[model samples]
Target: MESKLSRNEAISQLVLASSSPRRKELVASLDLSLPVYILSTDTDESIEAHWSPEQVVEQLSLRKANAALDLLQQKQAVETSLIIGADTIVVLDGDVLGKPVDDDEAKAMLRRLQGRAHEVYTGIACVLSSSGEAQLAHRMTKVKMKPLSEEQIARYVATGEPRDKAGSYGIQGLGSTLVDEIEGCYFNVVGLPLSLLSDMLATYDIAVF
Candidate 1:
């Protein structure tokens, strides 16, 4: 991947189009110190029954990147900007569980997730506004949750921590207590798959180290 990056002559244009602090921290952890700029566009995350989990996240991430690309072009910065967008979703038993709508919903989501292993898919998309070039990929991690009683689930939901997270929990925060084990990239469940993003960034000549 390093060799491929060298071949592209390197791309210095970097921008993030997300409001997620978790993603911001994940990106900063690379030591890039890059600027994060949110896009003016909003996405409707409703998924169709026909789409696979990968398709759901890939489309959502690409939509966000495209929105950011549009914003950059509006500012006439298209040629000099590389915009990134990412989306994550939790899948259990072929069902997609997004962020909870309320505390009750959060508890319900957690109840179904307890004692079960679910697949978390995070999609990352990078768009070079110059020449309208784009690349998108999705990574999946299997996360097993510790069994929880109704009381435990209700308690976690009442903390308001799970309301804003997919699958009603965050593996990188206080919610980490609920996870028993993870089968793949740990950062993926946190919101961004750094290793996967590093490789994806390489295709655009963006290096992390």
Candidate 2:
């Protein structure tokens, strides 16, 4: 069998502008065998309260990608690297939910989401350092959570799985049991939308098997 890396030209040397282990794992699962260089961008994600969730994610992703590009330039590495940056946010009833600040915050988020459908929006940005061209896109997934009793929320919070994740939950981890259904790309909820990322990469002559 051919090596997975040999099957695609577009993703052979992709850089991931994130430190998210979940995003890394999701990209690796594509079997592309590409080297992922993690360069966390120091971009402020605070958006105007009036901005929609989709817009917030998109802007953040672009900011991250640009920051990574600047870092690459400072390193004076070869200018052919393709950098990918992504951001995800959870939205409930027009409110943007980010990582929980504390255990109590996580519990509150879970309580608000209990037995309700919320939207998960993931924004992706791809930049070609040499050409200075970039592509941006957003993917939204609707997820329904099963009703959780007070005890359930407290128990889950104790596990500490929801502290570092948006909306205080991680669908790919212990939080999976809380999700009743998903209406779109499962990977999007996990962190990055591989299908959409692949599509965007393809535009730059990158391919994934």
Candidate 3:
């Protein structure tokens, strides 16, 4: 069989401008042989607290991509590199919930989500350093959480699994038990939307099987 990457010229590196392990795993699933570079940009995500969820994520993703592109340009190692930046946020009743600051905060977030449907928005941006072109896309998934008792929330919070995740839950981890149903891309809830990402990458001559 011919290689999926055969149509594209080889990339010097695939730079991921986020510190998310879930994003890394999703990208690795593409099975590309290029080196993976994890570059976390210190972009401030403090928005006006009034932007829509989709707008918030897309803006953050773009900022991250631009920051990484600037860094690559400064280093002058600007060979053919594709930088992928992503941002995920949980929206409940028009409020954006990011990672929790404490166990109490996590528990509170989970309690609010219990028996409620929320939206998970993930923004993806790909920048081609050689061409200075970037593409940004956002995916939103409606996720319903199963009703959880106080004991259940306490037990789950004690596991310390929700502290580092948006909406105080990790859909791919132990938090999966709290999910009742999902109405869109499961990978988007996890952090990245693989199908949409594949389509986006294809525009840059990168194919994903």
Candidate 4:
């Protein structure tokens, strides 16, 4: 009985390795007994041109999780940590769209995305600090956008929401107006897939229920 209690205490904390408000909110919604700690990492996000979209997000998520683990180890605060890292990307016509650097770029990405169906791929990685074991997974959602005129795209860009979002739109915010339909996990497009995360957490003895 004491051993079981000790194991529970060992995984009493969840470290989220991301700066995304959407991800933070999603994880918090789980209401797990384990306290959540946000740890954002600025790891390298560049990917090879030939890598598949799945590979891109998975590798990036792992990198972010590992980076966060390194930070916690340096601070000597990782003894009871289970770190999660996630990366999302927008793929249209075999091309990957990342966060735009400027309004013009955002506009261009939206332009191509308008009146089309694109796939949103989000990868999640969980690293157990005590065991140094990492698990990775990804979710894909097909999103169809409403046809928008140049004026509409310009107006959306003016709001400054797309500048920091991949594919130049956020489905959970004002950008929802631009989407006509989605065929997979909605939370995946929001930057984190809760259902998938919950399952991964279970593997580490972290239960939401």
Candidate 5:
């Protein structure tokens, strides 16, 4: 456990290493009461293509965090900031589905996921810039999509909400209507996992409350 921050010093320096708007919104709502700084890192997301979903998310999350930290150091901007990096992926039948590259690919991913259950795995990493100390973790959520007719899928796809999302769905947006039930962290499917994030921050002298 870390020492609690004083109200006078409560607004800790934070760097979120992600380009994801969904993740930025989710983290903002936590109200860590810190001076949050959002960073969009263009980290290489490619992997071996054969790694398990868990392994892939974990490695990618760490890479994003480290990449952001490196950038900060290069700029000599922040040495004591708490850095966060994360990645989310949809897995079905052992295949990892990342953000779709185009409308057609998004449609194909949605077509395959409809009327079926899939897993959303989100990996999170927290690193202290000063000490290079870090902790990493991941959460898995089971999401079951409602059976949709060709018309329903086509209409949803036409709306373009699925274009940039994994598995061609955004649970926090129009895609909510497509999910029948979810068996894990709701935020994980939305792009970040709050409970998992809160727990990780505890080690860095930050508290969500």
Candidate 6:
């Protein structure tokens, strides 16, 4: 049996269009032999009010991937690399809970999420730097938060882990204590769904072997 398989020869590298440390770490876990580059971009993330969670994440992810592709083109360094972009969001009671601006907002978001189940959506986009070929997909996970008290929420908020996280928590960090149960890809809640991402990469002749 073969322990390794050949990949697309034309594809020379993998470019991640995000600065999130968690995402970077997840990509590193794949351990692909190709060189991986971090080409973060400041793409506009705004969306229409009526867009559903799926639409919101998918569009934002593709937007970032395209922005990175443009940057590579301008530098004339787009030598058959693959650009990977992703976006994750938390939805509760039909409302999107983005990153909190302050501790008060974080506590408020957590308060609403306590003792309830919410959905997490993670969208992934892959663009071939050479031919401009693009692929997009998303994964949804159901997360149930344990019932939390005001003091517990306050204590967690003081830890400062929820500051930049959606739904005021990071399931992969200290926030794990707050979750009662989860259904679907665990990586989806972390930020980038590994299974979904691997599948998309396979379409571009990239495999995890």
- Tens digit per residue, CA lDDT, model 2, 139-203: 99999999999999999999999988999999998999999999999999999998898887666
True-vs-predicted CA distance for residue 179, candidate 2, Å: 1.0
Instruction: Give the clash count for each candidate.
Output: 0, 2, 0, 0, 0, 0
Work out the TM-score per prediction.
0.91, 0.91, 0.91, 0.94, 0.92, 0.94
Q: Which regions of candidate 6 deviate over 4 angstroms?
A: 1-9
Instruction: Find the 10 residues in a row with the least total lDDT in model 1.
Output: 1-10
Cα lDDT computed for each candidate against the true fold: 0.82, 0.86, 0.88, 0.90, 0.86, 0.90
lDDT of 4 by residue, 1-209 (tens): 12334444467688999999999999999998978999989899989989999999999999999999999999997457888999999999999999999999999999999999999999999887876677889999999999999999999999999988999999999999999999999999999999999887776677789
**Residue pairs in steric clash, candidate 1?**
none
Cα TM-score of candidate 5: 0.92
Better of 1 and 4 by TM-score: 4
Residue 124 of model 5, lDDT score: 91
10-123: candidate 5 lDDT, tens digit per residue: 325889998888889988999877778888888999988678888899889989999999998999974478889999999999989999998888878888998999999999
Return the top candidate by TM-score: 4
**10 residues in a row with least lDDT, candidate 5:** 2-11
Where does model 5 exceed 4 Å of error?
A: 1-11
Tens digits of per-residue lDDT for model 1 on 10-113? 34457777778898888888876345455546777777789999999988888888887777777876235677888999999999999989988898899899
Question: Residues 102-175, candidate 6, lDDT per residue (tens digit)?
Answer: 99999999999999999999999888787666777899999999999999999999999999898999999999
Q: Which parts of model 2 have CA positions greater than 4 angstroms off?
A: 1-12
Could you tell me the lDDT of residue 46 within candidate 3?
84
lDDT string for model 3 (1-209, tens) is: 22335424556788999888888888888897678888888998888767888888888998898899889888998478888989999999988999999999999999999999999999998877776566789999999999999999999999999988999999999999999999999999999999989888777566675
